[model samples]
Target: MTTPTHAHGHGHSHGHGIAPVSGRSLVTRLRSLMPLLGEHRRLIVVAYLAGVLHQLLLLTSSGIGAYVVARAAGGASLDQLTGWLIALGCLIVPLVVMSVADSTSAHVAAFRALADTRAKVFAAFERLSPGYMLERRSGDLGSAAVSDVEQIELFFAHTLSPLAVASTVPVATTVALCWFDWRLACVLVPVLLLLASVPAWLRRQAELHGHELRDSLGRMSADSTDTFQGLRELVNFGAHAQRLGLLRGQGARLAKAKSGHGRRGGIEYVATDTIALLGILAVLVLGARLVIAGDLDRSLFPVAVVLAAMAMLPVLKVTEVARELSMVASSADRITTLLDTPAPVSDLVSRAPAGPVVPHVRFDDVTFSYRGDQRPAVREVGFEIRPGETVALVGRSGAGKSTCANLLLRFWDVTAGSVSVGGHDVRDFPQEDLRRLMTLVPQDTFLFNTSLRDNIRLGRADASDDEVEAAARAAQAHEFIAALPEGYDTVAGELGALMSGGQRQRIAIARALLKDAPILVMDEAVSNLDAASEQAVGQAMEEARHGRTTLVIAHRLSTIRTADRIVVIVDGHVAETGTHEELLAAGGAYVELLASQLEGFVERAS
Candidate 1:
């Protein structure tokens, strides 16, 4: 596989670094979501307008209350009071209607944006190399796909509309207060500015705390997944208590981080409320003095105080969402980090070769190294398989047997030299086209958590029931599947846990058989089978080998005797290649490997 490189133009020794450019500020991180928001701009616009109207009505209530109190004290007529009350009632009804409409539209738009984001994340996962994916913990990746995406809803549904309304309502409220008295408007402006700066002052702390919280949650999730997957092993080893203690420690750390985050938020909250209350007191004091000096009308004194208090309300609303904004910033940073990670192999080829498919496969002076490995897994290796020929690659463990197969499958581009099928370089063909030309049965077969029929159908999604049954029978999996209570419809639990290893292998073989590709690669296909099942699978493989180029990565000596030729790989190079009897006579790597296997078999019998 291509080694992973840092793509964000910087490195962090401790953690995933923030995005090189856009991740520096909360506003920029939030702005990254605009494309998703743009998808539903109509809804967003309606939601924003409705939110503005809702806040306007709410702020208007305070002015109306002040007006009523002033007029009532001035001995207004009953008809005038009744008329004012009726007008307030009419305003309240629309306020409730707009409030509901705003909430509904905002939530719908938020959920839609969240869904689109999740889809994009999933597509990115597909484009990333499997080798790169293996380095990430399943839980951490899952949290990025699930939890992080969900956290963004707060930004879309709650933060966005309120931010929009807060930006406008405070100005509108100030203008109205200015109409009554510019002096009161001037007093309120500084207090609003100070309140708005609180989040900025706490920015660094909030980000640090938010990062800690998200990391803790991700680690805890990973630990939980590992524990559950290994529950049987933990119980058998009598280490369940120890595992539980570790999880408890993780929980404690998460709680402590959450506590710290909340404490910081609490301090900000108290400061904001204190500042808001003081602004109101300042306004009341200023208004009373102006009234006594006849600089302000007595009738408008209550109005000025109430409007000043109301103006600060929007600022308070903005401050209220500041905590959630910090969390959104942290989540966005992680998501951007993932999106920025470079794929191990780029899919740059756009079209398949125009010529006919070539069954002949060649690896010319191939060399490869896994990321972070000190030595190449395979080096300067050269081999070729003719069309319609069967070749067995026999080697001891770590001798680069599977690595060769993986190179042929293009799981990793060779670091040196070329792998070609049918005269076209594997890299030249689109990945989909290259994969379509070959079928592989890996050593460890993976079965999805689905019905047995569905698992087999994965090989050819449109294959009919008859075709699936035929392939299963050829793979010698039909009998067991037929015996199940649900027959082919039986559910295979997670990772095919409900079936024995051999059974899972047969199902995988059946899947390959259904594909009916021109090139077949089998890596230890019979490794898990018992003697009888091995014989059956071997017979099926022998039949399937006809008129197809086959590469078998074999450890067992008996399985390769009938091959057209045997190539013995020793220390990542081909040491010998000949027919079975010819190799035994040569008495090199192949003979030695065979002798060791025979010795083991004899010891087991004894």
Candidate 2:
């Protein structure tokens, strides 16, 4: 069976690295992950309870210390100190247990949420039409799947849950303080507002920086992809230095962006810290005034200070989390955009009547234009291929050869006319059902970075070892495949780079044979091969075409000579249609094209 091949020019890596810590938008971005949180509410509950218990233990230690100090200053007995110490130990044990349990549970929850998110993103990608995926960059998609997804884990594991607890604890503590001393509670309110507001301001700045950082990273990633994918071209043309200079500029731009974001972050931290210090100063001045005025006793001064200091821990923890949340927020926005992309096409089951013959593909006044493009790629195109007919399309680039092939495959719906297969409108058939009826081999082949056997079996998931080998032999790939150290089991790294272009083509042909579909479409199938490999692959193509409705996009003139019918397309219109000789005799566009290639045949024959 044939391996898949990625197209050559589609890598999208724009390389600003991931944004700095302070430049993230936590709230806006991480909201999507909340649905998954709802899905695993039980796990989240357990982790949250543990975190709350840990917070309570932390609160108790400070509260208990306040009681002990207040009593000792009032000249309480030694026995009271011993009793307080025992009480503190009780809080300590549970704090230790809850900390460990919460950490472990939080880790599991993070991984589960991330794994589910990744699976869903991949499934969404599958439902999208190949035409849609082709228009996007590989690197940007990868960043969403890998880097952006990773950013969300922090929010899921801790930040979001803690926000609720953090808010609750501070308000509760403030109320309790008022019960003890109303003046202290009143003084603390304004200070808490100032601290919260500081981070809120920082968050706004972070959101802007985060958006800029993500955009820069995308550009940097796109550049990296272009550099690596075109490495051979650069090396062959001796443009290595020139390419390196270009890459260096992209890298420098990214570094400068990152540095600017970092500087902004430092400013935010300083501003927030100054606000916190102002809070402490406000508390100290207020408590001192109350004590001197005798509105509060001198003995109560330390307890008020202790409570205020204890309250700051949760407030400060939240502020720190705020910065982290901003970063996670930026990641969330990217991931959400990817997930929200509409998949207009979806898998459908075949519902044809039992024993009914499968319908042959037909196009009736079909027209299609890509989104945002002014001109239609295929317009008023009409054609038909009966069962078992080998129809070849001959055209120059952008003459709608590939566009016709794409429409017939139902990659996009025709804008004006109907496209049908087996007497059913293409839209009526399930996407999977339509796919199952056809096997496609494009000019570009994409093989996974995986074992050759696995790539071959992708054609027919249940095919036997012998069948795979037989298909490979028919496609003229078995000899070279056998020569590899691991033979059929050899790994073809990243688009089958280990194999020659001819070998990769044969493998793709083998896969089409294994699919055993009623319809086959081969676009520029043997265009990349030398004469000998072309002859072998040509024979394999003929074998594959047997008893199937075959559509070939012929780039070379010789291949279409044996086609049952040849259709000439020029400037998005059908210029001629006939057998090879009939078209030659017509003295039209096909004849002109054939005349240009006559010299090559004469040289080969000589």
Candidate 3:
């Protein structure tokens, strides 16, 4: 069975643009979060309604106070005053209740939305290509995932419900004031509109500075993380002071950026407050004149003044959250960018292929390039491995050996041609199914910060303790593991820092052994091992290779001598292919590589 040529183009479109995400308008970017808001619509609606009720209670209290003052001055009965006081006292309990309910509901909804957003972001990270992730700084990505996502909570909790109250409360208060005197309502409406426009006028400046602040903070985070991860290297090279200086420089820039944005926000706050105060003052002066000229009733003058103050509260609320909205807009933009990015490899085929697992692999006229590279990393590369054969790929660094392995794993699709397994295009199988058929032991084994037993069990999650121990014995790791204080229960620490390089490599081999996939790819599997450990690992590989396909990527000649065939890769092309001795006898690239290694060894010895 052979895959048809058209299978290569089944779900991929070469004509689609593969550019980085572009910046969008603030409104458009923030609107992307509506789906998250819609998820908890009931909580949002309850919070908004509570906010409205809370504002209305305040307005009613103000109106009742105005009536009591007017009636007392006009010599009303003590009975009327007592009745008014009772009504005012009665509003307090529900007022406090509504206010608390509003705050609690909004905050709960915000946190829930945040949780969903982070989950989706994590899922997006999982779907994106490893190559794409490698191009970015891990710390910067962390900032987007953790810090940027946190910033959005302010918008959800404070801005969303308050925006609803701001829209409705002012109009309701204005209508109530009109029932007292149309003249006072006329004076306050235009002033309220001016207060609301203050934030809009400052929006562009806020957006510009907010974006700058977020970017500077992200850069600072990346720099700090990189410095810490490489602290050991810096100290060994006596470059700690220089690296510290660079870190301080990042900190200084971050401080400067934050200060600039803070200064502008402070100024906007002051301006909005001044406008709100002046609006209240205008209502007072205008209402007093109307009362004296006999155009307004004296008793209702205080009512108009108090209502005007109540009306401006919503506008003030809007202004208070306007700065936060600007800041959240920047955060929302970053998250949108991450979510919008296209996955480098699409898993279009969902079903597992129906056939026996042959373990044969083939690369047909494959070409690939890194995202920003001018030249292809691997050009017109092709290879074939028969069932149960062991093939070694020998090459210098950047010779596209690892790229070939990546293509086989379908970490990336071939830029041209196809990589097929068992006569089916790798793309025809789901990514999980394709990967399940093979196992990889990378040069730098990444052990989780977990027990030694659990790290080995990662390859086969359901493997029993006995099965795990058996795999460890096959890789010659059971001895060292058993010698530890807690044996298999010992923690590996970060990246297996608690263990020696050779021990880590053996554990990785044990993991691959436990997986027991039909196709095994070992990338410099013995490069970190000492002579004794290498011998043990070599025996393990020999035992594991029986009746299975194996691909070994190595620069060490001794490691490949036992391979059935050796293919020397030069400058992304297959330069020679034959048995180990045959390649050396041919006096080609493989022999030259061997000579170079020998020359280096001799030089170091001298």
Candidate 4:
């Protein structure tokens, strides 16, 4: 439940969840993950210690059993036999308990670290370019956040401690075996080495299949989400079968990936097991020869055989989990790639602008292009909205009308020039401060699944019920809200699905009005409303714009007529700037657009 602190550090500590280092290789990916464990790193260390203790107790039990086997038929006494039996019984309880404790602690630590990492990923999302989200599917990102992070648990909980025990116990047992008899130890060493190398031999195949499986899982998540959301539309349009067929194709691909991954896992397990069994067989054969030649004591030969199995056991432990090691590696790669994506905007940690700032917005010779674009989306676009002035931006589709609004908001920095607000560069203001001064009411404003009252209250959480109603009245949302079964208490449903497009737009307008920021940017807020609804929303829009610096990107000719000045954009530049009538009289780009709409030459609204 701990929150990661958003501070640059004097070396990393518990509060910082993101690692400073990054690399694409599996080993470096793993190294990067270590820094993110934060406070839970101590728990992983404890788990490793417990795993070692558990293996040591198991080895002790194995050695004692060999003593009874080698001596019972050699005329050993009943008392000698009973003492070994009691010692074997004494070892079992702690061994089982320590084994469970080791696994349980590792799992707890891993899951907590995963939680911390997930939280950090979400925090990173807030600072990443808002444009990045527009280019990716929500479900694909969700799979990374939820499923990918969850898969990494195998690395921390199962593989890491076992790998540690595999490294420690084999060397420790080899030393113990040498003390018993050096030749016997030498006989088992080569076979144990082969057993440990099985995973490495298949690492490439494992990585390939692992990546394919992860890709299929991500695609499945995204397609399934799309199928669900569009089910109603698909059914209505008689396209449901086509969507279902697409899903079936995806399912087949996912199944094939899982099958390939599983087949490789089986191969790894068999190879590891075969090598371990061979090591024990070699020990028995060599030990029998030594015993027959009188070069080794008969009693010590069984102990040597037991020690050989002991050496193989640790390696077997590591190779067994190696089956899932690819999954851990693949998941780690995805998580690191996302966490390492460069933040599009830097906060610079500058202080908020001083004094009573005006809400006027100015885009001065701004030029901006989206990431990976050859041509600029907005080129040399310049305009200004003085305090309390309402400016309308009109353009044909893809003429970069919305780009001007986005530039003023600083969602993406202008590539070649400055965007200023209140006579100061927008880049100098922290994003938090800029957001506080401006509110955007896009055509599709997201409404959470909550009571209507609460949804509007999101604009200003401390606003009173009376204040909420007053804002709704200003946006003409009050009448419709009152007619609902529960008035303001009615649930909005997911994305406001229960409401019509016009009603939703009005709700958004009300929310913005409630925020009462000095600057308002409405990007085609009423573009989707019908004739009747448009009139109501237009009046609401006028009410909301009073005394506020407003920027409007409108599609309807009627709405544009009310703006104090009109700026016509075409091909990413200003085509004309004047009042609606003045532009019509000038016979410039605005006149052509107006004539096109009225003469049926243009098929769509601006």
Where does the lowest 10-residue lDDT sum fall in candidate 4? 1-10
Task: State the C-alpha lDDT per candidate.
Answer: 0.83, 0.75, 0.83, 0.82
Query: TM-scores, in order shown?
Result: 0.91, 0.90, 0.92, 0.91
Model 4 over residues 1-606: C-alpha lDDT tens digits?
111111111112321112222235556656667766889988888889999999888888888888888899798988879989999999989999989889888999998998999998787677664654554566777787898888888787877788888888888788878887788889878888888888888777877777778878878888888888777789999998899899999999999999998998889877887777778888899889988989888877888888788878878877887777776777777677667776666675577788988888898898877655567777998899999999999988788888888878877677887888899888788889989999999988788899999999989999999999999999999999999999999999877878888888888888999999999999998877899889989999999899999999997898999999999999899988999889988999998887766776345543
- Candidate 2 differs from the real structure by a C-alpha RMSD in angstroms, to one decimal, of 4.5
Query: Which candidate wins on TM-score?
Result: 3
Model 2 has a clash total of: 31
Pairs of colliding residues, candidate 3: none
By TM-score, highest first, what's the ranking? 3, 1, 4, 2
User: Which parts of model 1 have CA positions greater than 4 angstroms off?
Assistant: 1-23, 372-374, 529-533, 543-546, 595-606
Instruction: Supply candidate 4's per-residue lDDT for 429.
Output: 87
Question: Clash pairs of candidate 1?
Answer: none
Which order, best to worst by lDDT?
A: 1, 3, 4, 2
- Evaluated against the true structure, the overall lDDT of model 1 is 0.83
* Poorest stretch of ten by lDDT in candidate 3: 1-10
Least accurate stretch of 10 residues (summed lDDT) in model 1?
A: 5-14
lDDT of 1 by residue, 214-323 (tens): 88888888889899878888999999999999999999999999998999999999999999999899899988988898988787889888888878776788898887
